[model samples]
Target: MSAEIRLPGLPLVALPGVYTPQDDTRLLLRALEREGVRAGSTVLDLGSGTGALAVAAARYGAQVTAVDIAWPAVLSTRLNAWLCRRRVRVHRGDLATALDGRTFDVLVTNPPYVPAPGSRPARAAARAWDAGRDGRLHIDRICDAAPRALRPGGVLLMVHSALCGTPATLARLTSAGLRATAIDRTAVPLGPVLRSRYAWLRREGLLSPAQETEELVIIRAEQR
Candidate 1:
């Protein structure tokens, strides 16, 4: 189950300015499959891009909520979910802010884990992947906020590159009173964003010139 899971070639109607599905998306889907999501399960897709994960979960018969900070991404998610005949509650707000006072059976995220030179992006396409230096910015926030957003026995399945510091993610989730482990891992090439900052990333010791691919890990944390 280490390979990316293709969604049977389902067409996603992604509009301009929305982040399209790619390797990380498939990887997250593979991890989601392992969760054994039951019919009518409540699922949340934080930072939902194009609502691909939401649609996938809906296809599995789960009630899905897809949240993104970008308005265009929200509309794209809504459109794609409708295109797939899957119902998704779409919202545009900072991560988890729009989801207050709600809990879910499962939470899945492929956040902006790419280490960036500065703070999170503002109104740029880079918002999809430009995480702050060391790439734990959103990851830490999720680990902190996820616990309350999950019901007892709830699970979180998050995917990020090894360069962002997997141990930190595991430690954070564990410290947040959840049992955390890397349930799955796979290698993937650097995307355009990472490629653009290759030199800085190398200097920061997150990568090497000889490296062609970075390992992506799915961290599964369960409520205690």
Candidate 2:
């Protein structure tokens, strides 16, 4: 199946400072659905914003665990999971070190992939979307950890903008010993965040002079 599964209306609540689910979020959810999370599957929702994907996975009978570094996100995920009547184990910690001894059948992440001129923000709302200059800070960490975080025959689902370099992500995952490829792609109008940084992106050659839309892709990686 294609990675373009439609997302359902999830009863999610995002607190102030927590990221509200947007295009990337919806795309990740669509990929998760297309993967067909099996009943009682062990699933990890890395960088869970509103825990929308976690809750959806739980609805499909997957045992979901969500991790985020921000307090607002941690509480928001818990609140939303409760609101949706789903059981999700939510943890708050740095993404790089969280879940040190854990692995799951499926790992899904839609991390901070926006290319930023400055370092990744700490304790700011921007932390939800801003990555470092190359926008591969969290993406790299996720790729490094995926091989160990996923059990054999497990799957990793990730979504990000083409501006961040889709081929790079696929190559990284492959080097980490997983078979990976883009499963779905769609173009979206630049959002407020991208629009705000249009000049910087253009200057850095991350975006073209006249480009106003960004392509988003869902990458699926399978463990050998």
Query: Which stretches in model 1 have alpha-carbon errors above 4 Å?
Result: 1-9, 119-122
lDDT of 2 by residue, 1-224 (tens): 11112347676677888888878888888888889898989999988878889999999999999999888889888988898899999999865555688889999998888888865364488898888888888899888888988899999999899999999999999999999999999999999989999999999999998998999999999999
Output the number of the lDDT-best candidate: 2
Candidate 1: C-alpha lDDT? 0.84
Candidate 1 has its poorest 10 consecutive residues by lDDT at: 1-10
Best by TM-score: 2
Candidate 2, position 13, lDDT: 71
TM-score against native, each model:
0.93, 0.94
- Model 1 TM-score is 0.93
Q: How many residue pairs of model 1 clash at the backbone?
A: 0
